[model samples]
Target chain A: MNPFPASDYIVAAFFLFCIATTVGGAFVAILTARVIRSVCGLMICCVGLAGLYFFLNSPFLALMEILIYIGAVCVTIVFAVMLAEPDEPPSGQNHGPGVLWGVVALVVSAAICWGLSQLSLRGPWVAPAARVNDGSIKAIGVSLLTTYSMAFELISLVLLVAIVGALVIARTGRTKP
Target chain B: MSLPEPFRLLSFLVGVMAFVGFNAAYLVWVERKSAARFQRRPGPTEVGYAGLLQPIADGIKLLSKQLIVPPGADRILFMVAPLMVMIPAMISLVVLPFGGSLMARDINVGLLMMFAFGSINVMSIMLSGWSSRNKYAIISAARIVSQDVAYEIPMLLVVITLLMITGTMNLNEIVQQQEGWFWHWNLFRLNVNPLMPLTFLIFFTCMLAEINRAPFDMAEAESELVAGAFTEYAGMGFGVFFVAEYANIVVGCSFATVLFLGGWQSPFGLWSGVWWFLLKMYALVFTVIWVRWTFPRTQFYNLLNLSWQLLIPASLFTLILVAAMMKFL
Candidate 1:
């Protein structure tokens, strides 16, 4: 009587969709000539990455990825795009070294991508014997406070320094202009 | 045969869409009438009874008009902007509790989900501005992002302080924590923490800014900006943004109500249930409208200053104080 695929199949289909989004988004980001479109590509990649995070059983990380990256980072990139330039200027046609550099760059990137893929696909993979924790929000809170408290405080300190430095730099820029 | 799960979700989405459509239209009418009353002028009494049908007429007019995509606009991005604005506002409603077990989907990190979705509205707005390629739109968009980032810090701090007290991120659980007599509401958490009222005020101000409502609506200052980021958006593209704005307002109010106003908990024991929730939410929306008509918009620099200079430090103080009180008490 069932017309739709089972839940597992749906999950698998969605997983494939996420992978496609990630790969396609990366392609769009690099291949696009316009900087604004590239920014949009990054946003799409983040959204797909967030989907992958969701599938990994961490909704909080998924939401944070979207909230921070797409919401803050991408928007900042867009602002820079608007203020500076909308599109990358055309690279004038040059013959000898330009072709050489393009081929070399392509080869290096392809090799790196291939190596990473091979390493991931062929590496030793095994399921854990049993779960240690449910990985709920409360569990995360407790872990951060108890086990990872030092790292958390360090991050806060780092953020404080970054904010202060940004303010100083921005204020200086204001005075000169 | 349809999968029952998706079918249910589809129906829920349909219901929510209907609600959003009806609410947005009715709100504009409410706004017009309220503005009229303030100025002692009759408002839209022609369409149906007391201008009840005016929204439909406006909708028809908007739909009938030519959707002029501005010259040299980025075709795809320009069209997608309104969808970006509306979708998040729609998705956020899924986690909201209408009454007892009344939410479409009660995710664990419900409050965080709302904030995450709410943040996307600004991005959509920026995209709309840029795609149009208008100078005023670009300037308005610039103001929006800066204002958003400044106000968001205080908003998150206020939420952090609230979570510290309630000790959960689930909206339903938060409401349950504040259940009981009227005094037990988080707004009047006077006994537990005296700083809540101020937090509420700060949070509400940030909410007004976040939704780009008036006084804080620096992005849409009509006098200077020429309709701001939406200058080039015409027809239903513009209509979608308007609808999304009101939808966000409703969602923001519901979130506030759930957090601070004891959710659906009646002020008195006699008047209990979902009606109370509706009343409280509508009351907040009404206040937003009333404030819009009453006050002149703030200067952009002053708007940013209010968030950074005043609100951020105050919310930070409140957060620390609340934490200390939670520890000492």
Candidate 2:
């Protein structure tokens, strides 16, 4: 039984807030003309998605979402924007190929949306008979080190290669004195 | 009799809020007095005895002053940035175990959660700088991001070293493992990790950089960047930034206390309680303030080099050394 009767209402309100934040942030990301604002919008969307993950009983994933996306990815984007031009180029006119391209883009997005909603709504949503683990940090750690050990090592190897490649590229641009 | 669940949660939240508010106010006084002492001068002896009422007066002054947005600044982001900096640090206080059974929430991943919220701190600084529309602030923002990114690696490496030795991410559990004598503490657990003290040093160094304290305070290097990221903020906006900085110091020091110095555990094996926790935490804070007053602000390139070049390899070495010791010894 629930101790606080109003807790359900509170949870529902928070859920609604998360949904609103996600949708609102995505809109800002897409509709904003400034690149910096768009990056901020993306950060907000990631935060909202983290909240949604928390609601789905995955606090680990939620924390990782915030840690990786909002912390690392968004900050990197902001850093890049700071170093580069931060504003979008102005659209010249409402007429011409822009209007046609916009219409076609809208149609494509609508179709994708329709297809996704249909697929999700009609898909089987049965609960699994048994969970392999309780999804605690310990469980995740065990599985990571044991079952997914090879995959984990591969990912780390790939990341190391990427880092070295990045260093090489960055080094090439600077002339030796 | 125990309080109801909601009531218990509410009381804990309120208690943590009060504790944060008190620390934020008084820590400024502590720093001022300590800095004064280091310089051989009387600090604030004005408002009340030893300037006890100074923070209150300062708070009132900051609150009464006007919050101004520069002509070209982004209004919403500028207004939201200070609150953003303050809130996550406050949230982190909820999970910090003050004494036995004194934590607000005992989540399994409490350490990770604190760090997750802690990571959000850099974003707020970046936003404040970028939104201010000031060149100095923007430069400060850029420096903060790179500084955080560089130090976070060694910080995480050192943490992983401790985690491997302790076998848990829960702050309370980590403390529990270090129960009994001072030698049982992670800092002195040489039987497990021979480089335990060095590991703590790496973590402390990273923490100093992480919280933007002196020597690593490139985010607000006043001589260089004109008050750094919060240059355009006025009154309570600046006041909140000041409060958040102190609050973050408390959080970071508390984290170090928990991870290394043994949270709430008495060193002499006598009465163990919140007092010991506070004693250790404040000692770390004092060290931090002392460090600020003593060392000159480091060069930005040196700051990065310290992290990427020296600290990272050293921490990685400690991690492997600890692992091998655990495996064979």
Question: Whose DockQ is greatest here?
Answer: 2
**Candidate 2 runs further than 4 Å off:** A86-97, A128-136, A149-161, A175-177
lDDT of 2 by residue, B54-137 (tens): 999999999999999998898888998999999999989988999989998888778888889999999999999999999999
The C-alpha RMSD of each candidate to the native structure, in angstroms, is: 2.9, 2.1
Give each model's whole-structure lDDT: 0.87, 0.91
List candidate 1 stretches off by more than 4 Å. A1-5, A86-104, A126-136, A149-161, A174-177, B1-3, B269-271
Instruction: For residues B1-329, write the lDDT of model 1, one tens digit per residue.
Output: 44477666788899889989999999999999999999999999998999999999999988988899887788788998999999999989988887766678777788888988888888999888888888899899889988898898999999989988887778888877767788889999976579899999999999999999999888988999998999998888889989998999999999899999988878765556788899999999999999899999998889988988999999999998997888888
Candidate 1, true inter-chain contacts retained: 0.39
Q: Which residue pairs clash in candidate 2?
A: none
